[model samples]
Target: MILGRSAISMAIGIWSIVEQAVAQHASNNRAKGAPITKNVSMTRAVYTKLLREKVFPAIRKKWPGRKTTTIMVQQDNAGPHVQDDNADILEAGQEGGWDIQMVSQPPRSPDMNVLDLGFFLFVAVATIQDTFDTDGLIAAVKSSFAKVSYHTLEKCF
Candidate 1:
């Protein structure tokens, strides 16, 4: 991988959107009468569901041009997102007759290192202070993401 500014500032398009789901079961504190739906962990099953039910559909609906274009979905080293999603994505892409592939992003890019992601860290910590519960946290994060514009992302690079 290149270690320069050019490597960090490539043409960017947001493909996968953030997904947050409520747990099927009640909170662990339910026995103490604090019952509430909790945010589910990012497990393989959950990621798979998001890819099949939400992401792919969204891509199909809003893709800029050519529905048959080869789409490369990039994800970080997150195990659930990269591990089996390759095979699963291949099969799903075939069923829909779309050329979709999941690619594991390199471990690091010079421009978007820890310093660039400081924007996210700041937003997360800033919003956490105003949130009181898991639901609030999720909402706050989603709101933060929604507010991010191309300008905001450009600053990161």
Candidate 2:
């Protein structure tokens, strides 16, 4: 799931909420190798696609008349994330007439990330009354993400 909040306006932008199907484990009696339950990890390819196909477009739509030529996307220092100078990303940005740049946050700085600072807590509170299965959890998360107010987000900054 990808969620963005505007720096100035504190507007929320929910780009995508994709769920990965869990791999089923085989019967315990079987001695043969079986697929273990897997959670999809974000890779450079997935991140790049999220930026090019989802994030950028949502940003453009959010501020229709504003110049988006110098948009900067801030991300955590994850191993699978693409570097700022990645060729495909640069090309995509250029094609969209945007000067998109991926910037990594300072190491171990949870304070700098709004999601870490407050959003997750807010979501947790919101979801306290709900009970859900795996797929329902995804839906609940997405719903909670949408319901978060701009004022709440602004306070986190």
User: For each candidate, what is the lDDT?
Assistant: 0.55, 0.63
lDDT of 1 by residue, 83-153 (tens): 63567767875556776566665666543353337447645665856787665666776565556654555
Model 2 regions lying over 4 Å from their true place: 1-12, 15-39
Q: Residue 79 in model 1: shift from native, Å?
A: 2.1
Mind giving the per-residue lDDT tens digits that candidate 2 earns over 44-72?
Answer: 78778887887767766775665554666
Least accurate stretch of 10 residues (summed lDDT) in model 2?
29-38
Q: What lDDT score goes with residue 63 in model 2?
A: 56
Which whole-number lDDT from 0 to 100 does residue 56 have in model 2? 68
What C-alpha root-mean-square deviation, in Å, does candidate 1 show against the real structure?
Answer: 6.3
**Candidate number of the best lDDT:** 2
